[model samples]
Target: MMGNFHIVSNNPMVAEKYPDLTEFEKDSKVKDIFAEGRNSIHLGANLINHPLAGSIKPNQSPYKSLVMSNEKGELDMFSLKLIEGALQVLKKFPPRGIEYDEQTLEDFQVIDLDLLDSAIDSLPYEYHE
Candidate 1:
């Protein structure tokens, strides 16, 4: 099954501007965490902890993806069958690439739970199902 994951942007500036993201510092426990096989970049904590816990390979899908929170408010919001669940959030906050190396910063992203809570509230029931 496809696991729940975050739509990480290589750019920290995006996270800095948005309240949803809290930047990772270089000394953080997860400072070195990165999507394996993919170019190293900032990873959202919500993305790193939940679905990618046992991740062993880079996503092979041609399309980039994200996983929204489920009705129970868990990040376990998507699998292969529930891809449509993340579409709306993805549309509104599409991930972007950075112009510099990601290792330069620290805080990956501690999801603004409040923002995610609200976003999850607005998604259709189908998204949670």
Candidate 2:
């Protein structure tokens, strides 16, 4: 990942792995994270990773992580549009009503973390910090 970007995540594993580079939102749901990303985009941060990256649907996983530009600049229409689309997709899926067990929750966290790692790994190494 580039040094100019930062992560916004509701997954504890992500927060633990990249403490300084993450804006951790404890106990936040997937939609909440997307909303936060949308808010950041409105404030001029561009989305670095797609909000709906993994195979896990919004209702399948409780955790979410997104990367965004750290520097605030002029509004990015692409980022705004992407985040809005994500929010709309989120609304299509009903909530995961059933409460997950501890192990299941941990599994969800691992999946989210893995997806985040993939995004970070895909970035060019030249600007990594």
The Cα local distance difference test for each model comes to 0.29, 0.87
Off by over 4 Å in 2: 125-127
For candidate 2, write residues 17-113 as lDDT tens digits: 9988899999787889999999999999889888895578888888899999877899999999999999998999887688999999999999889
**Number of clashes recorded per candidate:** 7, 0
Query: What CA RMSD would you report for each candidate?
Result: 13.2, 1.8
lDDT by residue (4-54, candidate 1, tens digit) is: 223333333333543253332323212122332122211212332232312
Taking all chains together, the TM-score of candidate 1 against the true structure is 0.21
TM-score per prediction, in order, is 0.21, 0.91
Report the lDDT of model 1 for residue 50: 30
Best by lDDT: 2
TM-score for candidate 2: 0.91
